[model samples]
Target: MKLQQLLSHTRKAVDEYQMIQEGDHIAVGISGGKDSLTLLYALHGLKRFYPNHFELSAITVDLGYEQCDFTPIKELCREMEIPYHIVKTDIAQILFEERKEKNPCSLCAKMRKGALNQAVKEIGCNKIAYAHHKDDIIETMILSLFFEGRFYSFSPKTYLDRMDLTVIRPIMFVDEADVIGFKNKYNLPVVKSACPVDGYTKRQYAKDLLADLNRQYPGIKQRMFTAILNGNIPGWPERIPYIR
Candidate 1:
């Protein structure tokens, strides 16, 4: 997808959920992946002419992976003129070596988000933007149903009262395929994940299952997304126009 198309989808989500406010500063959580990079570009493009005047910054929690290089990400942020911050932590060591947790994704995610939230708060940001997209939303619902026997997924907007921060998914309307296309078209410097279990997690299983189901029953992904929007799930904001 082109930058304009990305901005359109991002703006629609932001406006629908009232994610941004005047003079609000949002820190984009950069995982050095296509989704987050696409979000960075989308929000940067949206900042140019959105009705609300909001500031943008980028943050990445370095998991201390030796193979992961962030130089290109820094260059991209510099080129975009957005302030970028990297929080260095030994999360990889803690998860894999020290703790040796069998299921490290949940704890690793908590640590990463904790680090990210602290950094974002220190930088005086009122909101944090995550890059979760349409496919992620659907996969999460599937995971919930399969694991917990419940129909639940993350909301587009969430308020962390304890942290005094609001989290927003501006690109929730964007598709993962579009994210990959944007990365390829724009030559986004996507740093390959160095985690050993990068593609062998429960989420990955759900993702594959969702893909298979979508192939068998065309438009199943869209139907699932529509259900989430209209499911009246707790913490979900009021329903808004469904944008592609």
Candidate 2:
């Protein structure tokens, strides 16, 4: 996907959810993955010409892994002229070495997010941007139903009263396939994840199940996404016309 196409999709989501306002400062959470990198590009580009005139900064919380280097990400942020920060923590050691938790994703995510959120607040950002896309949305719903016995997914926008932070997902309209395409086309400096269970999680299982279901029934994923937009689930914003 080209940059213009990415901008179009991002604009649609932002407009639908009223995500950005004039003088808003958003911190893009960088995970060194395709989805987050695509989001970084989209938001950085949008900051230039969007009517709201928002500011941006990039941030990443390093999970104390030896092999995961963020030099490329730092260079990318420098090239984009966005302020970047990397919060280092001993999360990997705590989870895999000390605690030895069977399910580390939950604890790891909590620690990482807490670090990221604290960093954002320290940098004086009122909002944070996450790179979750369409595939994540569908997979989350499937995971919820299969594991939790409920129809649930995250909203495009959320407000945390405790932190006085608003989380916005501007690239929620983009697809995982397009994220991969954009990453290749733009040569995004993606830092490989060094986590032990990178692709061996429940989320991966849900993704595989969704792919199989989509193959057995074409357009099934689209239908599921449509249901999410119209499902009236608490926190889900109304669908925008541009999406259809």
For each of the candidates, the C-alpha root-mean-square deviation to the true structure, in angstroms, is 1.3, 1.3
> Whole-model Cα lDDT per candidate?
0.93, 0.93
Candidate 1, poorest ten consecutive residues by summed lDDT: 235-244
State the lDDT of candidate 2 residue by residue for 97-169, as single tens digits: 9999889999898999999999999999999999999999999999999999999999999999999999999
Candidate 1 structure quality by residue, lDDT tens digits, 87-145:
99999999999999888999999999999999999999999999999999999999899
Question: Ten consecutive residues with minimal summed lDDT in candidate 2?
Answer: 235-244
> For every model shown, what is its TM-score relative to the native structure?
0.97, 0.97
Pairs that clash in candidate 2:
none
Model 2 spans > 4 angstroms off: 238-244
> After superposing candidate 1, which stretches have Cα over 4 Å from the reference?
242-244
